[model samples]
Target: MTKTNVIRQLEKAGIPFRTAEYEVDEADLSGVHVARQLGQPCEQVFKTLVLRGPKLGPFVCCIPVAEEVDLKKAAEAAGEKKAEMLPLKELLPTTGYIRGGCSPVGMKKKYPIWLDETAELYGEIAVSAGVRGMQVILAPQDLIRFTGAKVADLTIV
Candidate 1:
């Protein structure tokens, strides 16, 4: 149970959260897999994605693990004409997080965050704890307040 930067940030913010740790399966880094490992529903586990727009630079979208981001909707949310996923090679340098472990919180900079509206359906949701095989479970409203995230329809229907 290592205290990752995400955990430390939440503590500093006085946000209450619980951490869950599980074995890391490099071959199955999907959020759905993580949720199953934690005995939770896929809709309650989110995956953080970083996307770049020509005008907006970078922004983050937190969507349910089982859904795919709708690039057109994401662009509209970010006020851009189009958006593209950030390349894997640039993730660490840009956000200080790697794939399968990128959390919406504790990035190098506070890029604008858009959380899928579906999150409101749950009282608590799980997101990466800034490391692989770990997740932070917290109230969705608390997370929204802490990150100043805008809630929207971010996933493909």
Candidate 2:
């Protein structure tokens, strides 16, 4: 696969990472499916989710593919009274990324990012490479350094 902005950015920053490519199934663009395709445990694959807080506008939350983001907990961590997922139609315009391909890194603009605490359990986790059908695997600490993500309880059981 041709390189995407996310890959280029990681390279430019000298962040060590490896790419994994898989077949695209437009109908099932779920992180769990991507993990299955990559032959990895679902918990190691995190999906980037964009949410709009009524008081704070847009922010990002990265959670495990097998789990869901707890909007209440996310809002609390973000210091907002409430937070809701951004409408699908606005994702591309807001972050320059499509629904299934959004990565916490290399967005059109920088927004506060939160990674589920579970990410620390692994040495490296997989996230989209700013495009569908590909993922970038890197150390969780490296990803945190690059995105300024706060490790928190962002996922639901």
Candidate 3:
């Protein structure tokens, strides 16, 4: 298996992780589908989202595949008045990652990252390996430490 930048970064940091590769369906890039393909619960798979605030510019949030980010909470977490999803056109330029393959670990720039509090509920969680059809599984705390991510209730109930 080819090692994505994410995997290489983790290895360089001495953080242990495992990768899962599955067939990718262009039409169904949802994390839910990825979870099903890996035989893992939906909650164990996280989707990376990039959002921007007028003042903060850009930030990231990782939430369960089936849940939605609470923009209000996200804004509050970022110390902004409001936050909105980063338009698709700007994703690649802003994060050096395209849709369906944005991994919080290896963005072009180190933007603030927030991992939904629910991530702590599991011993391991899967996140994009910086490419389609691949996922990196590791302990949530390790990810938090590696990425300097803040944990919070960024998801809607």
Q: Number of clashes in model 1?
A: 0
TM-score of 3: 0.98
Candidate 3: stretches off by over 4 Å? none
Question: Against the true structure, what is each candidate's TM-score?
Answer: 0.99, 0.98, 0.98
Q: After superposition, how far is residue 57 of candidate 3 from its true place, in Å?
A: 0.8
Off by over 4 Å in 1: none
User: Using alpha carbons, what is the TM-score of model 1?
Assistant: 0.99
Error of 2 at 109 (Å): 0.3
Kindly give the number of clashing pairs for every candidate: 0, 0, 0
Q: Which whole-number lDDT from 0 to 100 does residue 15 have in model 1?
A: 99
**How far in Å is the alpha carbon of 102 misplaced in model 3?**
0.5
Task: Please give, for residues 4-100, the per-residue lDDT of candidate 3 as tens digits.
Answer: 8999999999999999998999999899999999999999999999999999899999999999999999999999999999999999999999899
Error in Å for residue 152 of model 1: 0.4
Instruction: For candidate 2, give the lDDT.
Output: 0.95
Stretches > 4 Å off in candidate 2? none
In candidate 3, which residue pairs clash?
none
